[model samples]
Every structure is written in structure tokens, then in C-alpha cells.
Target: MGLFVHGDVGTAASYEPPYTLSSGESVRGGERRLWDNGAACGRRYRLRCLSGSNRPCKDGTVDVTVVDYCRKSPCPSTILLSTSAFSAISKSPSAKINAEYIQ
Candidate 1:
């Protein structure tokens, strides 16, 4: 099981693209590269989650790379992901999640 933190992009700025590193730092071009390589920002992830919601409950797997930055103040960390990223690992959306990071 992964320590998944799930939240709406609108609610959590971390869910935005151009993810801000927890270190309050980032690498130049790192975010763009991830997006250029077919990564989904919050928009894409949300669509996947909504779509997944319509399907039979199962452990859906999606390969998601974080991109951009979510500036919401209440988010625990700047690590943002597409809801599709969460859907890949979670079946329930109503519960709070602690997501595991895949290396």
C-alpha cells in the first residue's frame, strides 16, 4: 500500500501542474520535461478519476508523472498529481489517503 494524499485540484494547489518541491526548490526544465513526456496536469488526472468513477470498482493502474505547481495554501506538500494517478491506486474517493511514492 502507498501513502496516497488525494485532493481536488481546485481545493489543493498542490494538485496543479509545475509541482513545487517540498524542499522549496526545483530543477530547471524538470517540470516541462515531465509534461512533454505525456504527463497529465490536474486537468487530465481529474478526467481519469471521473471516468474511473463510472467503471466497476477495481484497482486501476495509471502511470502518472507530476508536473507544474499547485499554489493552494492548505496542501500539505507541493507534490501534485492527476486524480487519474490516484485512481490507479485507489477505489474509494471519499476517504483520506496516504499514497506511496513509486520510485
Candidate 2:
């Protein structure tokens, strides 16, 4: 599905994840489908960029924790990856790209 890359910080975690996140570990915010009524908090996923017209796919995947829920109007994408997570799997930083992910 389409991906949204967050800036320096992630969106608010509705449930307030219980565990401590490792320093430098990437995180993400999810749309409702992934939110699962806040149960998604602290869930981790492995994401890889899908090849697109602009060749936006990178060579590897990024593993990230679900730190929050995406609160954007219309909920722009399936998940919001942190900037570091996005850069690890995508060649184009600002372009919307499809992705393959496993939880």
C-alpha cells in the first residue's frame, strides 16, 4: 500500500506504548486498518519499497515499531514511516511510493 513518511518525529500514539523504544530505532504511525483500536502500538513491521515509475525502491527493508496512530485528515496512507525508516527503503524521499510489509 501507499506509504507516508513522517518528519523528525512520529504522530501521537493513542495508546501510549508500554515498552521503551531503543535509541535510533525507527518507528511508524498507522491508519485505522492497522490501528486495531490502539492495539497496534508497539507492534513492529518490516517494510521494503516497491519498484515504481521513478525507480523509488531501495535494495533492502526497514524494520520499525508502531509508535502511534496516523491522525491526518482522510488518513493519507496505510502507514506513516519515520524519516529514517523511509530513507532506508526508498530512493525518493518525498514521493509517495508503494511498499511491501510484514508484521
Candidate 3:
């Protein structure tokens, strides 16, 4: 929910190539993907999109790895999702919908 893509960032700098997720799973640009919270790198979380005006995600939930910091002065939201992760869980990559998270 409230999803946005970070393809502009390219890849995460905290880890090496072949970025493996906390689930021990890998996807294209997995090493480069992440949830941009103020949390430390490699933190993991379970995210669920709550239905609302905009249908955020096709799937109810997904697990995400935090690989970078979202330090925008006027931040859009608390969580910033990678393009791949956002697409996996969201129906539309640009919609902002309600979301819940557990770490």
C-alpha cells in the first residue's frame, strides 16, 4: 500500500552483488532492492495492503528487506519500496493505499 518505486537508486550499497533476501530468496535486482525505512540495513518486515479507494496490491501481503534509508527532507511516507517488491504486491505501482507492517 502507498507504494512507490526506487528504480532510480539502481542498487543498494550496503550489500554486495547477488543481494539475497532475509528469506534466503533472490529475484532480479534483489541485491539492489529494499524497503526504505530509517531502520538499519538488512532489516526485514511483512507488509499487507489494506483495501481502500485505490487497490494497492494484488496480493494481500509480502515480505520485504530493508536495504536503504529514506531520508527525504519532506518524506512522502515512512516506507519506500523497491520497484520489484512494489510490483509484486501492488496492482498499480503508483497508487497510495492503506498498509500495515510487522517487523
Candidate 4:
């Protein structure tokens, strides 16, 4: 349900989180990040990742700040996240997860 945002893999030396969402809202470093099905940006939501049958989940719940949109064209995926944000809540970045969202 979540994937790391492009150019945000691992930790960077500069380590600058996106300051402005595509929808024109301010964001900060180290804040939780998420993307949604509607490709909506600049929205905030509470996300809960359920533990899988095969793999255990980490940090099952998180408050996410939406700073970008996930597009279906070109590269298809949903819920792009910053590396740090994904790491905090999920055990592996590549895991397929069942998640709940609350605004």
C-alpha cells in the first residue's frame, strides 16, 4: 500500500523534506508522509497498516501528511511515501500491506 517516494530512498546528506505540496501546502522534514488513490495532495490523514499473515508489521499506526500525488500513468503505484516515513511504520518498503485511512 506504500512505496518510497522517488529521490527519497534511504537518508540523504542534505535531508530536505518537501516544503510545499503539489496542492500548495507547506510541509516539513521528518513528518509522516502518504499518498492516496485520488492523487490528492496537501491533505492529512491517519493511516493504519494491519499486520499481515506472513510478515509482521511495524508502527501499525501513523499520522501522515500528504505532500504529493501518486500517478497511475507512466509508473503505476499508489501511496508514495518518504523513506523515513515508510520506515517508521512498515517493516519493509516492498511489502504489500492492508491499510486504513482516516482524515
Q: What is the C-alpha lDDT of each candidate?
A: 0.34, 0.61, 0.48, 0.44
lDDT of 2 by residue, 25-100 (tens): 4454556877788888877777776655578777876778876666676665676766666778776666566766
- Count clashing residue pairs in model 1: 18
Give the per-residue lDDT digits (tens) of candidate 1, residues 1-103.
Answer: 2233553322111132343443322211123322344343322232122222334334433444343543334444323444444445446543234332332
Single out the weakest 10-residue window by summed lDDT for candidate 1.
7-16
Q: Estimate each model's TM-score.
A: 0.36, 0.72, 0.56, 0.51
Rank candidates, lDDT, best first: 2, 3, 4, 1
Backbone collisions counted per model: 18, 0, 2, 0
Winner by TM-score = 2
Cα error, candidate 3, residue 52 (Å): 4.4
Q: Best candidate, lDDT-wise? A: 2
* Model 3 poorest 10 in a row by lDDT: 7-16
**Winner by TM-score between candidate 2 and candidate 1:** 2
RMSD of each: 11.7, 8.6, 9.8, 10.4
lDDT of 3: 0.48
TM-score of 1: 0.36
